[model samples]
Target: MLPDFRLTDRTVPSAIEVYGIQGNAQYVARKAEKQALYAREGAPCVEWIPPDDLASVQLPPAA
Candidate 1:
């Protein structure tokens, strides 16, 4: 999966995705699929939904 942001410095796999479009059926389905994939892979996935500013998002510390 291509994440919006990837933390390559982390010891474990970490991904950050920004979901800006909420109403589209295809987009929502894709988001769910990605979440499931992350869970199955035991990766740390962070999801960001608007209207929260990305600048204020609290990201996990790098390793």
Candidate 2:
């Protein structure tokens, strides 16, 4: 079964923001599939870290 999904478009100066909602939906779908597979194998699913923690990670410069 697929999870419920929604999308909203917004005008923004950045290309990233324009595409952010679609990107987020893709991420959720991927994570949900991983979680479902883990559940089927009787393995613990990893919890997502809070956004603040994610934001604090130092990412390499974008190519």
Candidate 3:
């Protein structure tokens, strides 16, 4: 199954308009074909940065 990409009319003023909530629970279930799934098991929530940081975040050099 393909990953779900949520889109709105929101336009981000960045070089690339990459956007969305990634890999939600439903997405995982679908991708796993309803089989037993595993995430971080007992991991804590990730402390994500603010949205604006995404615009300026530098990507790794292309391989």
Please give, for residues 1-63, the per-residue lDDT of candidate 2 as tens digits. Answer: 222321223231111111123347787777667567656865432242344354543322332
The regions of model 1 sitting more than 4 angstroms off are: 53-56
TM-score of 1: 0.80
Tell me, by lDDT, which candidate is best. Answer: 1
At residue 47, give the lDDT of candidate 3: 23
Per-residue lDDT of model 3, residues 15-63, tens digit only? 2223233558774445344222213233111122346565565532332
- Candidate 2 C-alpha error for residue 35, in Å: 0.7
Q: Which stretches of candidate 3 lie over 4 Å from their true place?
A: 1-48
Query: Per-residue CA lDDT of candidate 1, range 14-36, in tens?
Result: 79899999899999999999999
How much RMSD separates candidate 3 from the native structure? 12.0
Query: Which run of 10 residues does model 2 get worst, by summed lDDT?
Result: 11-20
Model 2 regions more than 4 Å off: 1-23, 52-63
The lDDT values for all models are 0.86, 0.39, 0.32
Quick one: how many clashes does candidate 2 have? 0
